[model samples]
Target: MAERSTPGSTPGRLLAPPSLPDGAELVMRVMPMPADVNANGDVFGGWIMAQVDVAGAVLPARIARGRIVTVAVNQFTFKQPVSIGDLLSFYARITRLGRTSITVHVEVHAERDPVNPQLVKVTEANLTYVAIDGLGQPRVLTRQV
Candidate 1:
């Protein structure tokens, strides 16, 4: 890969961009608005976490084939600060499938600088969601015959 200045870094210095996780499926893409920015001028971490939860549920929702609720955020990491107007792409892959819960690994990448064009891994997380029934109780995942 051609070297370019890493996102949020000074120009003239070259750094190779990190590679996206293998086999992860693109789940969501969104750009933060000015309103999402925090006092430090970076996008609010809470907003990003909320987005992650939604993106992380994509695969589990499909597998659950019904109502599902986030039961846990097993892990979360912020690699870089997000800026307003940066296009963020969320990628997710199922790491575990249980009887009624599913765990997913989510990676968030920020694409910035229209002129230079850099994609940086900004945030990553592992979340678990449980299948729910009408009563909002955990429901067993039906086996495919």
Candidate 2:
């Protein structure tokens, strides 16, 4: 399902993926506001990076079955500028699993003009998450059946 750009208004444009390569799933959609923009009038790269971190952590948090913490963000590339009123969608897939950490590959796509519904991959990144305990200590993840 496509999420609306504003909380109460209908989505001006659908942000659904035109196609996913393979083994990837849509995770979440976010709309950036003016507050998130930089002095250049484009959404800040830090904001996009933060969203990617959140998207990368989702599955590992579920699989770890407990508290998790962001351990690392290996690489992030910004391919396009995100503007206000654009719908941003994140897609993620687990790429590697270690005893206590998991790597997630995330792709960010933006709807240039929601009214037109055209989607473009604006950024991509690989993030690693580690399972953590209540005290914020690393813990090994138990494999799920």
Best by lDDT: 1
What CA RMSD would you report for each candidate? 5.6, 4.8
User: Looking at candidate 2, what is the lDDT of residue 105?
Assistant: 92
TM per model? Answer: 0.86, 0.85
For each candidate, what is the lDDT?
A: 0.88, 0.83
lDDT of 1 by residue, 44-98 (tens): 9999999999999999988889999999999999999999878888989999889
The segments of candidate 1 whose C-alpha lies over 4 angstroms from its true place after superposition are 1-18, 143-145
* Per-residue lDDT of model 2, residues 1-145, tens digit only: 4643644546553345767657888788899998999999999999999889988888888899988888888988999899998888899998899989999999988876544456889999999989888889889899751
Q: Model 2: which residue pairs collide?
A: none
For candidate 1, give the lDDT of residue 63. Answer: 87
Candidate 1's displacement at residue 109, Å, is: 0.3
